[model samples]
Target chain A: MREFANKYGTVLVVGGEGEKCRDVAESYGFRDVITPGDIIKANAATAPFRALTESEIKNSRDLLARGGKLSDIVVEAVFVFADSRDWASDLQIMLDIAQSKGGRLETRSENFDEGPPIYFSHNDVLWSAAHEHVRLGMGALRKIVETVFEDVTGGRKLKTHAFGKPQVSTFEFATRLLQQWRATQHGLAESEPPETVYFVGDTPESDIKGTNAMNEKSKNEWYSILVKTGVYQAGTEPKHKPRKLVDTVLDAVNHGIRREMAKLGTRKDGKGRKLPLDDAALKAISEGRTPNFDLSVDPFAKAVAQ
Target chain B: MREFANKYGTVLVVGGEGEKCRDVAESYGFRDVITPGDIIKANAATAPFRALTESEIKNSRDLLARGGKLSDIVVEAVFVFADSRDWASDLQIMLDIAQSKGGRLETRSENFDEGPPIYFSHNDVLWSAAHEHVRLGMGALRKIVETVFEDVTGGRKLKTHAFGKPQVSTFEFATRLLQQWRATQHGLAESEPPETVYFVGDTPESDIKGTNAMNEKSKNEWYSILVKTGVYQAGTEPKHKPRKLVDTVLDAVNHGIRREMAKLGTRKDGKGRKLPLDDAALKAISEGRTPNFDLSVDPFAKAVAQ
Candidate 1:
C-alpha cells in the first residue's frame, strides 16, 4: 500500500464502515485516500439512490473543496481493504472509476484499459458470523463487481488482484510468521523449521486448496486436514482433497500426534500413560491411512449443520 | 401480482426506493407487501451494514409485531417491481426467503425448492437515465441474485418469472391495447385490425427481440426497426437482429410510411405533394432494405453518444 503512494497521484480505498478504510490506507502511507463515500459526497449524482448520512458526508473528505473540481482528483489505483458496507454505491463508484479515462471521475475511456488497477485484501465469499448461516464476504463483492463490470462493458472483464488466504503471497507470509514464532516461542533455531505442519480447515476451496498448493511449493511438509465443519459438507466429495479428513480440530490434532508417535515406534508417553489410539489405529496411522473412529461429539458441528 | 395474492401466504416485494414499491403493490390489491427494509427493521441483524433511516423504518411495516415471531411470518413469493435502492440488504433478505423452509425466516429448507418463488417486472440489464451512461436495471440484480444464490446453495438455480417487455404475455397485452386504441381512437372496427405494426426501439435484447417474437405469433406483421441510439451500439452486430436498422426513431417512422406508400403504388400525395424519399429509395424500402440516407441530425443522439 505504501508503495502505491509514489506511483499514483490519488488512490481510491473502497469498503469498510464510514471512513475506516480511508484511515487505514492513510495510515499505510497513502497520501490521498479517496473513499466511495467521499466521491458520493462530492457528486451525489454518482449514485442517486445511495445517499450518505450527514455524519458520513462530514467524515468524507470533500474532493471538490480540495481540488476545486471533481475531474481534477484523478484516482490512480483502487484498494479494497475490507468488506463493503454499501455495495451499491461502492460498486457504482468502482465501475465509474474502472471505466474512466486516466482515472478521471466524469470521463469515460474509449477502452477500459486506461483505468487504474484494483486490488482486494481477501476473497472469502462466505464467512462465519453469529448468524445462523454464513454471511457474504469481500469475495462476493469482488464477484459482483466483475460480473456487473462485464455486463456494462459488453463482455470486457474487470481484472482484480487479491492478497489473502488462498493467494500464494498470504501463505508465504504465514510461513514466515510461523518460522519467527518457532524461533522465539519454542527456542528452535531460525534455520530449523518443523518437519511437517498440519493445517486443519473446513473450506476446501480456500483453506484446503491453499494448503495443498503451499505444500507443493514448500520444502517442509504442509499436511492439510479437512474437518467436517463450516463450508465443507459431510458425506460429499470435496473439490480439493486434503491429506487427512477429521471430525473436528481436536481429532486432527490427535491424528497428527499419533502419526508422529507411531513413526517413533512409541505407544505410551514418558509418564507411562496409554495413547488414545489402540494397536490397530496406530498401525493404520503408520500406514498413512485415516483410522475409522466415531468422533462426532463436537458441539459446534451441530450448529453449523443446522 | 394480484394472481399471487390468494395463492401465497405472504409476498416479499424487493426493490424501489423507500415505501414506494409497497404502496404500488397495495394499490394493485396485494393485501400484504413486505419490503427488504421491513425485514431489516424487524431484525437489524438481517443486514448489519445497511441501516434504514428513522423515516424509512417508520414507513416500513413491522412483521414481528404482527406475527409475534420473525419465523412465523412466512414469505411465499417475491416480486421485484423496480430497481433496488440497496442491493446488499435486498439481496440478503431475498436469499434468506429463497432458502428458508416454507418461506419461514429462520428455518432452512432441506431442498431449497420449498422456498418462495421470485418474479421480476423486467429484465433490462441496462436502462437510460439522466446519467451519462446506461445504468444497471432489475436484470443486473436478478443476475446477481441468481449468481450469489447458486454460489451459496452449491449449484442450485433460482427460478424467476418476469412480467415486462420481451415476454410473450407483455406483447400479447400490448397487441390487445393496440387493437382497443385503433377501435376507439381511429373509429375502425375491432375485427379490422391494421395489416402491419412497425415497432421502433433502441434496445435489441428486449425491444427488437420482443417485437420479432410477437411478429412470429401475431396474424399481423410486426416489423422490428432497431435504432442505434441506446444500448445497441453502432458498428457492432447485435445478437438479436431487427428487420431494419436505422439512425433514429424518425427514420424508422419515415421508412415505414414510404414502404406503405410504395405498396399503394404512389410516389406523390393526394394534393400533388412529393414524398421525402426518391423512387429508388422507395423501391429499396418496399424491398425491405433500409434506405441509406442522412438522418444523424437527431439532437438526442449526441447526448446519448456522450
Candidate 2:
C-alpha cells in the first residue's frame, strides 16, 4: 500500500482504534489517518456554539490532561473501519462536526441542518465473538446512528457510503494493493498488470458479491471460488454464486493455475500445466491455516496498544 | 376527566414527573399511574444484570436517606409523558426490564431478543424550553432509546407505541374522557353522547390529525379547529387541515357553537345562536391560558422535587 500510494498518489486512511490506528498507519509510511475522536479533541476549544463556559473550559482542561490533541480539524470524508469503542461519545462528536459551520466547532453553519456523507468499511451486522451470543458489529452501530440522525434532522435523507464485503471499494483497494506489490517486489512493469485475479473464500455474500461487483467495473476479470470451510456449508445454496465451488483452498489454487495456463495457450496434449499443493502447504491447510491476504497499512505494535 | 373516569370505570395515567404526576392524578381521583422513572427506581434491585453491588446498596441507602420510598414494584406497562431528566439511567432500567425474564429483575428471559413494546406520549423532537436553542424533548430521547434497542437486538424490528400528537391513542383517550365528563357532570345517558366534538388547538399535526383519525373510527364526529395562539402561525400550511382556522381559541369556540347550533336546526334568519365567552374566559385565552391536560397519577409534591 505504501508503494502503491507512492506510485499513484497519497492514500487517506481512517479507523476505529482512535490514535492507535493513526500511529500504526504512520509507522507503515502511510500518512493521513484519523478517527472521530481526533476530530472532537481538535474541536474541544470551541464547542456548544458560543464562548466556552467555565465548565466547558474545565472539561477541555481535563481532556487535555488525559492526552487529547489540539489541531485545526477539517473533514472532507469519514470512513469507519470498525465498530467504535466509544459509540456515544463518537456519535455525539461526529454529529457536532457534521452540523458545525465549515467543520468549525462552536459555530453553526448556514447549512448545519444536513449531515455529511459517512462511509463504513464493512456490513456485518453481527460478528461471532468469544461470548455465547454474537456481538454488535459496525453495521448494527451504523443503523443506530443512522436512525438517530434521521430523528434529529426531522426525516432529512441520510447519505452514506458502504464498502467491504458485498461492496466494490474493498476489493478495488485489495486489487490495487496486489498490483503495487507485484510492481515493487517482483519488478513487474506498470503497463503489464495481471489480466485476471482469482478470489477464493467461504462466504458467498461478501466475498463473491464484492469480487463480482469489482469485476463489473474493472478491466481485469475476477473469478470467485466459494469454499465450504467456513460460513458456507456443504449442502447450502449460496446467496451469491461464485465462478466455481471447491472443497478447500487447495482445490481453488489448482483450478486457478490450470485455467490461467490454458488461457496462456500453454496446453500440451489437451492438458494444461497444474500447480501441485506441497506437503507443507497441505499440512498447514489441514491445521486450518490460511494466508493473511489483508495488506496491513499499520504495525502490530500499534494494534496491541488498543 | 376525574368524573368521567368515575362514571365510566377506571383510567390509568403516566407522566414524566414520576411520583409528582402520580400524586396529581391521585388527587384528581385517578386510580393508577406509572412513569419510566418509577420503573427504573423499582428495578434498582436488579441493575447491570446482576445482584446488588456494594455501590448499588450504598446508592439505595443514599436514596432512602434522601426521602426515596421503599416498596416492591411491579410494572405492566411503561408510558413516557415528557422529557426525561436522566435519560441514560432511564434507558438502562427500561432495557433491563424489557429484556428480563417475565419482567423479573435479575433474570434473563429465554426470549430476551425481542424487547417489550415501548411507548412515548409526545413526539416533539425538540421543544421550546427554558433555553436558547430548542431542548431535547420526549421524542428525541425516545429515538435514542429506540436506536440503542435496535443496536442491541441486531436490527430486529422494533415494536412500540407512540401516542400524543397525531396518533390515535391520545385522541381516543381524550374522547373517552370527554364522554365520561358529559355523562357524569351533565347527567347525560351513555346513549345520548354528543354527536360531534370540537377539538380546538394551536398545533396542527397533533390536534388535527388525532381528531381526524378518531373521527374515522368513531361513530360520532370530531370537528378540528386550528388556533394561531401557540405553535400554529398565520399564513402557514398546516400538516393536517382543520374544519375552522381561527385567530384564537375564542373564535374557535364561537365557530363550533354556531356550527353545532346550525346542525341542530336552530338557525333563525340565517343566523345561529352563539355561546357567550365571559370576561374571565376571554382574558384567559388572551393571556394564553391552556388547561393542564396531562393527567398525573403521581403526587404533585414529588413533581415539585423534580
Candidate 3:
C-alpha cells in the first residue's frame, strides 16, 4: 500500500479524530488531513447534536489547545481506508469538504446541499465487536445520520460512492494499488502491460469474494489466496475456497507471491524484481513515522475523555 | 357478576398470592378460594418449589397468624386469573398438590410429574412494565418451568395450557361465564336459541381479532365493541374496527345490546327480559365493591388503598 502511495507521489487518507487524521496525514507526507472533530472542537453549536460524553469534551478542548483545526486545504482525492469510529461526525466533516463552494472546506456554497459523492470504503451492515452479538457498521450508522441529514436538509437525497473489500470498488482500488506497487519495484514504465496480481485476504467474504468479483471484471490475470487469521477463524468451513488456503497472513504474503511469480517466469512480458513488505506496509499505514493512538479522532471519544 | 355467580352453582377459584385473581375469580362467584401463600403460611415448604418476595414473606406470616391457610375443601376447578407475582413460590405450592398424590396441598406428589395443567388466563410472551421497555410474562416463566419438567420427565411435554384474550380456551371460558350471567339476570336458559354475543374490549389485535376468529365457528353470533378506556388510549386508529366503537365499557355494553336487539327485532326465539347494564352492568363492575385497577385483582386492596 505504501509502495503504491510512494509511486503515486502523495496519498490522502481522511477519517478519525481530526487531530489523529491530521497527524496521520502529516506522517504519510500528505499535503494535509482533516477530521470532523477538528471543526466541532473549533465550534460548539454542531457538537450538541447528541449528548457529548466526557472523552469527547476533552478531545474538543485538546484540539483547540493544539491549534491544529479545520483550515483551508485542497485535496485531489481520498482513501477512506477504514471505518470511522463516529461516522456521523466524520461524515459531516467529509461532506463539508465534498460540498464546499469551491471544493474546499473553508469556502461556502449556496448549493452546498449537493456536493461530491462520499467515497465510502465498505458497506458492511454488521461487524463483530468485543461483544457476544454483532455491532452495526457504516450502513446502519449511515441510516441514522441520513435521517438526521434529511431533516436538516429538507429531504435531499445524499449521493455517495464507495470502495473496499467484498464490494467491487474497494477490490478494484486495492488491485490497482497492488499493480502500481509491483510495477515500481520492478521499474516498469508507462504503456507497459499489467502483470498478474494475486490478492491474499483472511476473510473469505471480503478477500476471496472481493478478488473473485474483481477477477470477473478485469482483464488483468488474478489469483485469490485465503488466509485464516483476521476475519475467518477455525471451526467454520470456508464459504468459498480460494486458489490455496493458508494458515497466516505472513505465510500467505510469502507463498502467494512466490507461486504467482513462478508461473509468471514462464509467460512473462517482462522480468520482475521481488517486492517485499519489509515493514513498508506497516510504516506507510503508520503514515511514514510513528503512529499515535492518543491522537483519537472521534468527538465522542474526546467527549468521554473530558 | 357476583350476583350472577351466586345465582348459579358457586364457582371456586384458587391460587395467586393474596386475593387479586381470587377476587376476580370470586367476582363471578368462584366461592371457594385458596392460594399456596395460604399453605406456605401454615407449613413453610409443604410444596416442591420455594421462592418468595420480602413483602410476600411478611404477608404469609400475617396470614398464618390469622389462620387463612390452605383449606381442606376440594375446589371444583382452578383459574389463574392473572400474572403470578410470586411465581416460583406460588408454582412450588401448586405443584405440591399434584405431588401429594392427592388434591390436598398437605400431601406430596409421589407422581407429580404426571400432574394436572396449571391454567393461566394469558400466555403473552412479553408485557410492558414501568421501569423497563418490556418484561417477561407468566408465559415465559411457564416455558422455563416446563423446560425443567421436560428434563425431569426425560422429555415429556408438560400439560401446560393458557387462557386470556388471545387464547381460545379462556375466551370460551369467559363466554360461558358471560352466558351464565346473562341467563340468570334475564331469566333466560341454555334451552333458548343462542344469542349474538358482542364482546366489548380495548386492544384491537386481541379482542377484535379473537372475537372475529371465534365468530367463525360458534353457533352464537359475534358482535364486537372496542372501547378506548384502558389498554388503548385515544388518538390512535383501532387496528380492527368493531361493530360499534364506544368511549367506555358501559356505553359499549348498552350500545351492543341495543344493536343486537334492534337487529333481531321484538320477535326473536332467544328473547328474554332486558339485560339492563345501565343499572346492572355498572353494578357488576362497580367502583365501590371492586378495587380500582386496569387489571391485577386485589383481594386486600393493596395498589388502590389510600
Every model's TM-score:
0.82, 0.51, 0.38
Please state the interface RMSD for every predicted structure, separated by commas. Answer: 1.5, 7.8, 19.6
Residue lDDT tens for model 1, B163-252: 787887888787788889999998877775577889988788799899899999988899999997777778877878999999987778
lDDT of 3 by residue, A69-118 (tens): 43344434545645554443354455445445544444444544644444
Residue pair clashes in candidate 1: none
lDDT of 2 by residue, A1-306 (tens): 355324322222344433555465457565444454433444532222223335434333232343533324344445565556444445555554455555443344444554345667677654444322233456655665566666554454455667777778687778778888889998887555577899987667578878888888988898899987655657756767998999987678767755664443433565533445455644444454542233465444563476
Model 3, which residues run further than 4 Å from truth?
A1-122, A125-165, A175-197, A229-241, A264-270, A274-306, B1-207, B217-222, B225-254, B263-265, B268-270, B275-306
lDDT (10s digit) by residue, model 3, range B240-305:
567777898767755754564444444458665543344443443443232123436643466237
DockQ of 1: 0.45
Ranking under TM-score, best-scoring first? Answer: 1, 2, 3
**lDDT scores of the candidates, listed in order:** 0.80, 0.56, 0.52
Give lDDT for model 3: 0.52
Name the candidate that leads on TM-score.
1
- Report per-candidate DockQ: 0.45, 0.10, 0.02
Sorted into a CAPRI-style docking class, model 2 comes out as incorrect
lDDT of 1 by residue, A1-306 (tens): 567767776899988877788788888888888888887787777776777888998898877777488877788899999878878778888888898998988788877778888888888777665566667778888888888888777788888878787876777888888888999997887777677888888888788889999999988898999998666767878888999999987688778876776655553445433447777876777787766666668756775688
Candidate 1, residue A44: how far the Cα is off, in Å: 2.7
